[model samples]
Target: MSPTVDHYRIVPELTVPGYASDALKAIVGATHAAVQANVDNLGAGTPSRAPRFVKLLRDKQIVDDKNQSIATTNHNETVSALRDIEASMDVNDEGVDSSTYGTYSVAGDAYVDIEKAVNQLQGTINDAENAPGPSVDAAGRQYWPEAVEGPLRTACATTAATVEQRMWDATTDIQRHAEHINNSAPDNPTSSGYGGTTAPLTTPWSGHSYVPPADAGTIDKIKGFAANELGVAETGTNHVNRPYNIDDAWCASFATWVWKQSGINVDWSNKNYVPSVWSDAAGKGWADSDMSSARPGDLVVFGGQHHIGVVVARNGNSITTIEGNSGDAVRQHTYNLAGGNFTGVIHPPAKTPVNA
Candidate 1:
């Protein structure tokens, strides 16, 4: 008896385009295996071999047909979707309508929240764009742009120049004043030390200048008294009354008279001896033996304390003096330290004594 062959038919179903070719290949392989098994059993003499071969061939053809149908459907679906997108994108200057793309209206609360976020973002951008101008740090230093810094620098430079100019003006004024003091002369004939013109003979001297002390008023008073007596001789009626006659040595008397007129009290009052002035200064601790330590208005004792004069100015080794009895009248004289005529200097108190 012949064995019965059960023939199973494969029906093609609609599959996704991606898996259609793989499914078709699997169906063809199964048909080929079934035909191979039937032929191996039937051999060349069996009539069933041709029928089984035809059936396998028919199954492979059906799977190929199904694969083609699936490919065509997928292509059509893609074309339809693309055409719908193109139609929706069709615009004519009138902006995209909500109808063609799909209506999308934000909820009221969500719209308000998004608007607030956008405003905050805009505020941040504005702050970044419009920043503050130049400022100063806590350390009192200025940090500024070149535009502001330029004017400040110029102002500082201008102020500095002005200050320098003022300093130069002050210096010139001081020099002129020194010259005036150096050139001044006594007006009266009896005031000449040697009974001649009381004007200074040498050119105005220059050297380190010093600040006049508070009692400089006393010096001014002494100078004024000496100037008032200029050109008057000891024999003249304007001379101060002394214990001795007008012809005797009046230098010491004249110095004491000037001091008296200036309201200054000294031990050598109404006395003609010059050494007494040095003694008084020594007793009072107002004497300076060093000539270089002498300042204007100091009493200059000369000829080993034989003569005394008021110092007008000091320039290096030279000193200008206003003296009485120099050539028999009040006069201005310039003396050199090298001459060894200057013995000592007597310093007057800066303030007059209240009692004396």
Candidate 2:
């Protein structure tokens, strides 16, 4: 630490004497030690604790400055802030106030805690290097924390990163576990079915409709209209090599037919872009969206060489789409699993569309 850039120097008047120098020195020393410990954190096998790097920052404050009071102040401030943040992470103003209530708890402290954790890491690491030694704890486990000049820092860092990553992985794991449980149980169905039949979730379902499909066979009825009634072309595609079969990959045509049956208007003559009973009519784009106004029969078109489907139901990432050309079967399928040849979807025009 030769020719250290005096932080107090920048604040001219503070460089005068005792108070300024003392404060600056204390802060600088604490900061330096924190950095050192952080470096040690980069070690292969090093001693560590939770509030992980945060604890290191507080502990090192004392080690670097030998000022117990200062360290305590810094540490308590951090801890208090952390706790407040944690508490705040889930706030609800719905206390005796109807307008203030919400469907879910607010992000009371996550934003703050996450920010503090990040700032703590940056503040310490930016100023100093790692501290040293073979770290041992009561548990008798050893770690290679980054020492001021040893290979420890790398190890500690790798470990911290690993732990952080693991934490992230755990969150995903929880979500996946929940998904698995949901998938495993038949009682807690995945998607809300059209007529008491649940399917896997995929896209968003928002609008509430009192009218169920006039009939489950409504899906088939729509297709029949497109095939025998509407002048829809039975176009073939070299999409995957062979040609189009009425029984396979006829998703676009099937959807086109269904949209028309539900009283949703589609420009059947327009082959390049299928006239969605929804988008072309309702005006919802892929940009920023708000479907609070979307109705039941609106067409949700999946753009790509004219592929489309009908939105049977809408609830984010869990849409119920009725389609025809889905791998050789025309049935209701999930949006999430809509892969390969499956494109986007079309919300059909409601039962009241003029041209529908």
Compared with the true structure, all predictions reach lDDT values of 0.44, 0.33
With candidate 2 superimposed using the best TM-score fit, by how many Å does residue 78's alpha carbon deviate from the native? 92
Off by over 4 Å in 2: 1-249, 271-295, 303-306, 315-317, 336-356
Tens digit per residue, CA lDDT, model 1, 1-356: 01232222111211112212332323223323332232222221111212232222223232132122112234344344333322222221022111112111212222233234334433432342245433556885534443432332232223223322333343354345434532352223232332223464243222222333456576676666655555443455325333323454566667776776667767552266565466556646778888888766677776435567777667898776677766555667666655645668887765763221
Best by TM-score: 1
**Which one is best on lDDT?**
1
Q: How much lDDT does candidate 2 score?
A: 0.33
**How badly does each model clash, as a count of residue pairs?**
20, 58
lDDT of 2 by residue, 1-356 (tens): 11332211111010111222232333333333333222222120111211243234334442222222222335455444433322221121111112211122111122233334445544443333333333566787644332321222222233334434433443454346435533352321112221123233233322222233455344444433432222222234312221223433455555554554545445642222333222333332321123343223433444332344555555654455554443233345444423323233333333433222
